[model samples]
Target: MTYYVAREGSKLWKRVLGETKVELQLLGEKWKLLLVGVILQYIHGLAARGVHYLHRPGPILQDVGFILLPELGKERAYISETVFSFMFFSFVLWTFHPFIYQSKRFYTVLLWRRVLAFLVASQFLRIITFYSTQLPGPNYHCREGSKLARLPRPDNILEVLLLNFPRGVIYGCGDLIFSSHMIFTLVFVLTYQKYGSRRFIKQVAWLIAIIQSLLIIASRKHYTVDVVVAWYTVNLIVFFVDKKLPEMPDRSTGTSPPLLPISAKDKDSKSKEEQLKLLNGNSLDTSDRRPRTQVNGKHLEDSNPVNGDATMNGT
Candidate 1:
């Protein structure tokens, strides 16, 4: 019993040490990601504030999606918020999945770095898009009865920066054109599709993402175009960004799998197999055709086949 305990304890220590070494080696990369992430988030926050201040109440534009789908009531709008919150928290929980799944290659920090990269690019485009034109706000907060219908002009830069925080986004207006909520949802879904192991969970993730989009549209939290644009834009951003990023290392091999075309390897293997088969066939044919002598009504073969010399025995 003691021996078993000691063996297990040693294994645990070794794993911990190995993980530590890998993390320490990546310390510089981790810090760089952290710094860039913080800066990008701050810039996005400021941009959101600027767009919100530029918002003006106007007639809602004619939208095909609105004509097709009925706008959900205020209660349903709250439900949409709830659903988004669930997705956000679920993604946060999933970020730490490497701990639960025991994957050396897929660390929580690495996942965050990848997610941050995708979001930063997405948000950067969003800022440029929303800044191009101010659209009429569509949510209940943008309507007359709501207290937050029209945002008061900012007195100073500090107020503008502060207003872009979480509380501000809750009742804020004019950061449309592409949905931030959809960006997060799609990023999480795509990341899970690539890295997560369970088939059921992957399907469930996609379902949740689809449902989340519907809820955003139904609740009128965003214009239909916002949701529609997000659907394709986020998907494309993830696809392209994933292509640029380094592939994750496999735990067993401690190296990333090659992303080269599979047909090349297959062709090489096939050629080798063909050559081996031909050599084998030729050897069989040569052995059968080799000369044999009959001595006293019995067949005898050469002692050495390599030289191909024939020897005869006579009575």
Candidate 2:
């Protein structure tokens, strides 16, 4: 898949993406890794809900509601709670979009590991750092005379797990310190930038995120502080995840580390020497780069595993 590497500029995302004809493929298919990701998301959701309810049946904090973001507001967009639904609907769609499109397949094993790790860490952090505050919103007015007089009754982890569907999906008012929509937006936006695509597509991906976050404020689903904090938190996570989980290489190779950590050049000359030593049963130098060997010497002469048959020089 093509990935757009942004040029050096203030608006990095606006830089055009070009393909160098190098199609990167991971070592073999990672169907099982993708499957594990699906399962982990389910577990993460379960755990998030489990911990979310632990601090519930508590006091309401509507102090964050007074700071009006009227400029970003859409009049009556949430008149009957439609915008919130659309926000949620779009979020759900975006969650699975890359998977279906295959243009930016989230199928890489390294990517899957990073995503699962992010979910685990974020959820754990959210669970431990419970801030009992409510930012004013359409479905989240915790005042006494409001439709929802107080926050919903807290449910046990098992009960929440069993109750499922709409009930499980809904979040309470006090859990609005940070917005998941913001975090999710960053995830997809960075993913678009990483997977090699047009600059326009990348911009649109991030634009949607910004609009959604603004709408969250307009619709009163979150405070400005919520969105701000989420942006910072998710961005930090993105940096670490990218640094730790480097992209995988060609799919034909098995699941082994590359000879050079970040070097595209194979160090073929060096590998060739190692291959010859292995063939002759020489004790190798202490290095992690053990050369690839022919399985049974049943392959072609060109398949000498490194520099073809040229190394069998005087034979």
Candidate 3:
């Protein structure tokens, strides 16, 4: 069966516009997709009577403050709840926006990859980790020697803010279960390597993920061991999937590139021109027919007279 899709003005527009829209849609879809996971986690927690089957080491310093200063204990709970609420709402918005609109075919692949990684694979891994490790609860055994322990002290306004409203609306038990960090970072790195040009941005983003994971561990939000395992697991899954999955062909070569309305002939012609321009180092100008000379002894003639010389010299 044939499918009808909207076309854009140019190949560049098609690739960029199509990809952008797809990304937005995929992002939105993730929130909705995660809703099921959220419900399941809550159900599981309720079934377990708010008792976690497995837990990682907690922050020793924070635990000490809780024991020594009861006031800090109250503050920590409040902060945790507040931060969690904020993170939850933000996640809802970030993950649900895509379901409101239809996405193009190119985006569908990306959307599926994310859904599989977070909604399926990551959750499975967490369950296995929980079962195998048989760790303590989310807040147990916090001591200086524990990998999950954090130095207990309000260092600055940031720590105080975190202490007061510990939980951001973005992350929660449900999110933790699936390790969104792993899913997102893996997808982002793979996607960037395959199609994106911003290598620096991708690298920076990966670094940020690593730092954030460390911070979470240091803060006693998650076990250092869990985070480490999650990093390797996610990277392995992404790498395998990326290797097995077929690379997307250059859509501009086909008759209908996504979001581009131009015919295949036009695309081919444009690409040919572009290739020629790159090779010759001269772009046709729309101004006077001045025979511009390149430093490398090449000559170019302007086709139209509206603008000026649009040629470049190799030298």
Give per-candidate clash totals: 0, 5, 31
The candidate maximizing TM-score is 1
The order of the candidates by lDDT, greatest first, is: 1, 2, 3
| Per-residue accuracy of model 1 over 1-315 as CA lDDT, tens digit each | 999999988877777676565555555557788779879988887788777767887777887767777888886678877887888898898765444445544766677888899999999999999999878888878755566766677677777767646778687788888998999899888988887777998998899888888888778778889999999999999999999998666553557653333568899998888789786543334457655655555545764433333343221
Runs with alpha carbons beyond 4 Å of true place in candidate 1: 1-25, 103-105, 252-315
**Model 2 CA deviation exceeding 4 Å by range:** 1-40, 47-68, 71-113, 131-141, 146-158, 250-315
Which pairs clash in model 1? none
How far residue 10's Cα lies from its native spot in candidate 1, in Å, is 11
Ranking by TM-score: 1, 2, 3
Candidate 2 has its poorest 10 consecutive residues by lDDT at 15-24
lDDT of 3 by residue, 72-186 (tens): 2323434533444444444334333333333222344343444354435555556554544433424332333544333344356554333233232222221233344444445
Task: Write the residue-wise lDDT of candidate 2 on 34-58 in tens digits.
Answer: 5666776676566545444443333
Best by lDDT: 1
TM-score per prediction, in order, is 0.72, 0.53, 0.41
Which model is ahead, 1 or 2, in terms of TM-score?
A: 1
- In Å, residue 195's CA in model 1 sits off its true spot by 0.9
lDDT of each: 0.77, 0.53, 0.46
